[model samples]
Target: MNTVEAPIDIATEEQSIEVKTDNSAENESTNDTSNLDKTEPVPIDVPENPEKIEIARLSSIITNQTNEISDLNARLAACQQHYETLLNRQKEENSREKQSTVMRYAQAEKAKLDSDKRCEALATKNNDLLKEKDNLQVKLSEFKLMNTKLQNAYEHKLSELVALKKELEKTKEINQSIDASLKSTLNHLKGESSHLKEQRESNERLKRDLNEQHELNEQLKLQYKQLTEAARAIPTDDEQAQALDTLRNEHNALKGKLTNIQDENKLLREKLKSSDEDRLALENVIENFRQTTMREKETTKKLYDDLLAAREQDSVEISRLKQIESLSNQTLADNADLRQLLEKEHQLLELTQKLTEKNSILQSDYEQLQLLHKGTSTDFECIQKINEEQKSQIAKLENIEKSLRDQLKELDEKYQTVNKLYEQSAKQYDDSLSEIQTLKKKHQANTKDLIKQLQQLQKPKFTNNSNEHGPMLLTSPTKPIANKENSNDNSSSHGSPTGSFSSLNEITSLAVPGSDHIPRHTPAHQQQQQQQQQQQLLLDEEQEVIVNIVDIDRQKLIDKLLKQQKLLVRRNEKIEFLNDHIQLLTQDLQNKRKIIQTYAMNEDSFMYTSTESDSIKQQLANKNRNNSSSLMATLYNRATTTVNHTTNKLFEQSSPMTLETALDVMGKLQSVLEDTLLKNITLKENVDTLNKKMPIVKSASTMSESTTNEAREALDCLHELSQLLNTGLDKKTLTACVRLLEAGVHPDALAQIVQVLRSETRTTKL
Candidate 1:
């Protein structure tokens, strides 16, 4: 009996330990399950002692913490509002400042306009002074020429005076000779001496008139000296004064016009000095205007730079706002999803609580059946009592088994339901995750595209800003907010409050692990559920991490896209600018071509005229050569004839001379004539040769002109063809044409037509 009792005791103790272990394992599983649930609260086992009271106290502490979190959230909302308000105020202030800057710029522009007007006026005055100076220079040159002529005239007059003085001396010498002769006659005849005295008296009167003419010459010399002194004192110089003197002398004899010439010279000198002063003043004014205009231009550039900076800042701020709005919307969506997950978890918790309550009732029934079996066993005989106790125990055990079976069935059904719900939730979560991923991918793509566009737009602006305003400081406050990490604990704690409250009682029931003494099915099922819950929790955590990663990736993608877009935009702008530049260059090239064409036409015309002139010159040279040849030929013939005549005369004069001598002289004359004739014919032949080359040269020039005209016509036709092609093609076709043209096709349209034919052939073959 001791051995049997010992085995039974060992079995009972082992069973009890196993039960305790199951309860402890269930409690541990519940804690892990609750942690993994993300929404359901963990159930605590209530004790019949002070431990239960401690749990209540702990519950109150959690409630207070929740209230604090709520208050913090409200405070955070208020702070966000305040920050938004400050941003708005700053924006308004910036706008006001921008307006003030614009006003200042306007004032500066007005000042610039006034300065420009002044500059224009100064330029006009300078131009007028330049004209006056040019006029003065012309007059001064004319005066110099006049002065030169006057000096020449004065030299001629002095030479004439010297010649007149010499003539007077000769006449005086003749009078002296006549006087000597008269004295001698008086000695010869005393009566004739008286008549000679009367003649001598008449000569004395003629000498007195000559002395009066000499006195007039001395007065003219005195006037010339006075004019020279006046000319020296005036700024016009003696040369101009000499010019005036010659003019006055032409109208009046020298004594009457010296004072008038001096006065005119003084007036010219005064006017020249005034003109010089005016020119100097105008130059100074022009210099001042140039300096002021330079300053105004600098100021205008500064204002333009500031305006560009302001506009860029505004664009950046607007972009930031849009990003912030997108992030806020994403956060709201995440919160809604989290709320739904929490509600589902709360429902699962309530079902678990109901299963635990059913287990507790089955445990109570099993204990009562054991008590009744114990009490009946002491009142009966061995076999009968054994039988009755067995029967009653068997019935009670059967009822308890049935109840356990019923509870087991209910637990299994609930387990299945919970499992189904979990599977559905997981599926839903997976679907949501897939949808979110898809949306994220699409959003990333779209964001990348948008960023690219924005970047493209901003690049030129940024480059322009950098060029215009040097370096700029850019501040982005939204970057910090967007990059902030979400706390995992906070995300788990903020469950749907309404769902938690509705399932509060069920949560309390699940706290007692051993209150239901059913078989260990619930523990095993709960363990499986806990594992599933942990897996779901892990998935949720992974999804959160994935979401965060996706967000970061998306943001990175957006940034990359933006950068690409900016690069593309900048490239596009550069391409457009290059195209514009190319267009301008083409226009310039066309203008140059036109200029070249005009030059070619002019050159051709000039060459034609020159060729004609050369022909005329050749003709003139030919005529001159012919005239010279003819004159030489006639002279040669005349000489030949004269030689022959002389030879014949010589022969007649000396008939006795030998026949060989006369014949030799005739032969020499003939040879001389032949040589002269040969020289004349050679000159004539050279002139004829030159004349023949002139027509060939003219014909060559005409051929060259014709070639040039043909080349010009070809270019014009090519240009017309290009214009027709441009008009015939749309943008896409034009682009194709351009590509074809670049590829060296003479006619882009022909190349396109060929391509179309090839494509059609291919299609027909297909």
Candidate 2:
């Protein structure tokens, strides 16, 4: 009966301990549920869709926590009922075994003390759980704050988008206005062009009239010179009078021709005035078009910039969202880790239950031994020492678990920081790549536009130059046909013209009765006709020479333009190569930085090249500020200088430089640069190999630093040059100057020629 009472007491104590543990778990779950419920909601006056989703998630989390807590409470209540039942059974046993009640009571007190110690341990565990829950609550609060910030950012983005839309609408209106202006200008230009064509025809006719007047003046001068010579040989007063009559008749004919020439001159002057007015109108229209195009370009650039800014903002927001998601995931992981810890604690409770069962078995064995040999008190004290050792071991394990948990938290934080850094780096890389692609596309488009503009500009110049040659081109085919017709008519026409001249001479002779030189004067008139025919032949030859000179000049201009285009293409290629190199260098630097960061993150886990890492970091920092831009600029400068040197050298060797020769020279230079690039790449590989083979970190670091610095400087130079390239060189007048320079023209000569061309263009425009 006493033994049964002892077993009942042990069972009651075990049940009480189980109930205590369940109550502790219930308390912990309750605390977690309360913390979840107490989590602050995002402070928003007007919640959007995202806010609603977040609120729903939070509510779900609270409900889940509550349900878990309720389950724990139920478990605890069941444990409490079991403990009560066990306690009643022990009380009944105590009543039945009254003889050994005092010993059983002492054993019960010991069990109670053990149970109290375990309850204290459980309370500490519950406190740790509460602390974890508090940490979770803090994280939730931080998440909520982040959400609020994101919402604010979202609202700001929406506002910005709306503003952008308004700007777009305004731009559309402005574009419409520009289009309308363009259409009006185009119509105006069309009218001007038609008027110019009519004026051109009038000018051509006036030129013919002026040529005729000039021939008449030459003929009159020759006749006067002949008459003065003949006057010296006058034989009598009658002959002089006859000469006077003949001179008077020639003077009358000259006066009538002069009057006709003056009328033509007046018409030419009136046409000139009309043309001047038309030119001024056209200039105004051109100015208006230029202004409108400039405004359009400005608006388009503003829109592009705004779009890029918006894209960047979106990317930033996406990065932020990703960061938030990572943080939330980390929190969930931590929660999972906490759940695992709780599960382990539950497992420990089961182990403790098993140990208690074994303790009960040992106690029963000790009781049997005490009954067999009444001196087992020392053995019981030994069992107590063993139990104390187990308790110490359990305490050490708990301490180790706490240390492990702290380490896990540290590792998690480090991982999160590293992840953030990696993400930021990747984002920057992607943005850079995207920006580069866009810039390349823009460059191509701009180049195409420039080419088209150059072609358009060239067309007008060609047309203007060709206008002077138009009549020559047209007359070239008709001249032979007219000459053939003239040859066929010459027999009949010549006889008729001679007979008329003879008849006029007779009439003049009869009218001047006592003249002896009338026949001689008829022969002199014939001589004048032969001289006029000779002058006509000379004029035709002079016109041909003028046409040849014009053709030569046109050819030279075309060749120069072609050379400049080739040079521009080579320059563009060089720029593209430099850009690619910069991108590659940037990628390499990013990769190295990533590696260094990873090394730094896992410093304890692996050996790291500290010197190399430090050098790389220094290089990166320098590149970020000014070195990169300077490096790019220097590299571009070097390439351009090399091209200039090569071109000059080739220009000297080839006295008559052709387009093909210039193109070949440029290709050679490009190849040389490519070879140099390849050599540099090979050298880099060799250095890397050497570094791998031998730990010459200082040397490697020094080399890398130098290379990085140079690269940075080149980048800077390239950026500055690209800016200049974009801003400068828009004027059509500059094309000739650029072409001359590219064609290896002497600067002084080029300047003079450009000035002359510019003046000529200005005159023409006027």
- The C-alpha RMSD in Å for every predicted model, in order, reads 67.1, 46.5
lDDT of each: 0.49, 0.54
lDDT of 1 by residue, 1-766 (tens): 2222433554575576567557655765675566446434434754568666657666865775576568656755765565445434333343354345434433443344445555566556556655756675675576566556655765665576567557657755754665465344334333323433453465456457546645766665577667667767766666866766775564365334445545654664464455346434533543454454455456556655655654565565556556545655655565565555455544443443333333333233322233333433333235445656766876798679779877986897689668756865775687579757976786576556655654554433332332212111111212321222223333334433223322432332242233234343444544433333333333333334433433334475577557756765776687579768967986897699769857874563324443223333333433444456432122212211211233323213322334664365345445645675699899999999999999999999999999999999788657845764645444654554444444334564344343443332332332
**What would the TM-scores of all predictions be?**
0.14, 0.25
lDDT of 2 by residue, 190-303 (tens): 565566557657757866876886687678668767776777776547776686677768668867876876786577567556755754564465455555555656766776
Off by over 4 Å in 2: 1-213, 224-766
**Global lDDT for candidate 1?**
0.49
Clashes of each: 8, 20
Residue-level lDDT for 162 in candidate 2: 78
